[model samples]
Each structure stands twice: as C-alpha cells, then as structure tokens.
Target: MPRLMAFDYGTKRIGIAVTDPLQIIATGLETVHPKDVIDYVKKYLLAEPVERFVVGEPKQMDGTESQSAQHVRGFVTLLKKNFPAIPVDMADERFTSKMASAAMLAGGLKKSDRKNKALVDTVSAVIILQTYMETRKF
Candidate 1:
C-alpha cells in the first residue's frame, strides 16, 4: 500500500512527514530547503510510493488567507503539475507552530534542541499530518 505524505511549507524550509503503509501514524521524514523540495520529494518517491499529499494551509484568525498562503499556493501548483496522479489536499494550519512547540516541550527536549527551527518544522509537519488524518477537512 502506498503511504501518505505531508508537508509543512515555509519560504526557507519545507518539513516533510510520511505514514507507514498501513497509514497508522505519521513520522517526520526531513526538513529540506525550498529550492530542493521538489527534487527531494522525487528522490523520496523513488523509494517509497506515496498515494496522497497533504499541505498545511496557512489561514488567518478570521478565516481569511494569510500572507503565507500565496507562497504555499504557488508550491501546490507546482506540486500538482509535477505529480498530477497523486491527490493533494490542504488542512487549516493555524496553531500548528504553537502545538509543535508544546509537543517538543512535552517530549522533554533541551532548550537548545527546542530552539531548532528545522525540528519545529518537522514536528509541525507531523502535527499537520495527524490533523489531516483525524479530520480530513479537505
């Protein structure tokens, strides 16, 4: 069975996560630079078959598009063009960062470790993936 992949996208870094073949749990895969994201995913696809893609969609408190949404949308467009066969969907990513932080703290990471943005991004991607699986708001 093909796994499901999720991304927590940023201008600088793109956090990636994937589920097992059973799609039971999401695991942080890697945090890659934006310039290398597509190629990185392609490389990963060579090893693992991914059936679906989930992206964390940024939104404002009032349910409007956040400034980051435009950038994410651009990435999404490129993603769809590159892999039209796989379906892509978005989940509301309002408090994922905060949740990631809390998760890191609860997970007993050191202060310096918790400050790592890459780890935070990866955790956020995991959170996004979990949210997608639970609610599937798309």
Candidate 2:
C-alpha cells in the first residue's frame, strides 16, 4: 500500500511527514534544506511508496494568502513537474507551529529540545498530515 506525505515548507527548511501504509497514523519524518527538498523527496520515494503529497498552505488570520504561499505554490509546481504521477494537495497550515510548540511542551520536552526548529518543523508536518487526514472519510 502507498502512503500520503506532507510537507511544511519554509524558506530555509522543509519539514516532512508521512502516513503508514494503512494510512491511519501520521509520523514525523525529516527536515531538509529548501534547496535539497526535491532531492530528498526523490531519495525517499525510492524506498517508500508515496501516493500523494500534502503541502502546508500558509494563510493569514484574515484568510488571505500569506507571503510564503507563493513559495509553496512554486514548490508544488516543481513537485508536479518532477513527479507527474503523484497528486499534490495543500492543507491549511494556520497555527500549526504554535500547536506543535504546545505539543512539545505537553510531551515534556526541555527548553533546548523545544528550541530545535527542525523538530518543530517535523512536528508541524505531522500535525498538518493529521489535520488533513481528519477531513477525509477514509
């Protein structure tokens, strides 16, 4: 069975997450540099079967597109071009970072550990994936 992948895109770093083959649980995967994301995805795809890409879509509180939206759109275009067979979708990413931070704190992470942006990114991706999954009937 194939899995669904999610990405929390940033200017400098990208957070990644993927569901199990059963598509029931989402797990934090990795964080890659912006320039290395495509290569990272390619390498990951070689090992795992990914059926779809769910990218975090940044939006303002007013429901307007955020500045980072353009970058995500560009990345989506690149993903479509590079992996035409796989479908790409966007999940609203409002407040995921904040939610991730709270999760880390609730999980008893230390200040130093919570300060790791990469970890936060990964958790954010997982949150995005989980949120997206909730909307699907399956």
lDDT of each: 0.94, 0.96
Report the lDDT tens digits of candidate 2 across residue range 72-126: 9999999999999999989999999999999999999999999999999999999
TM-score for each prediction? 0.97, 0.97
How accurate locally is residue 28 in candidate 2, as Cα lDDT from 0 to 100?
A: 98
Where is the poorest 10-residue window by lDDT in model 1? 129-138
Tell me model 2's lDDT, rounded to 2 decimals: 0.96
* Model 1: per-residue Cα lDDT over 55-95, one tens digit each: 99999999999999999999999899999999999988899
For candidate 2, the TM-score is 0.97
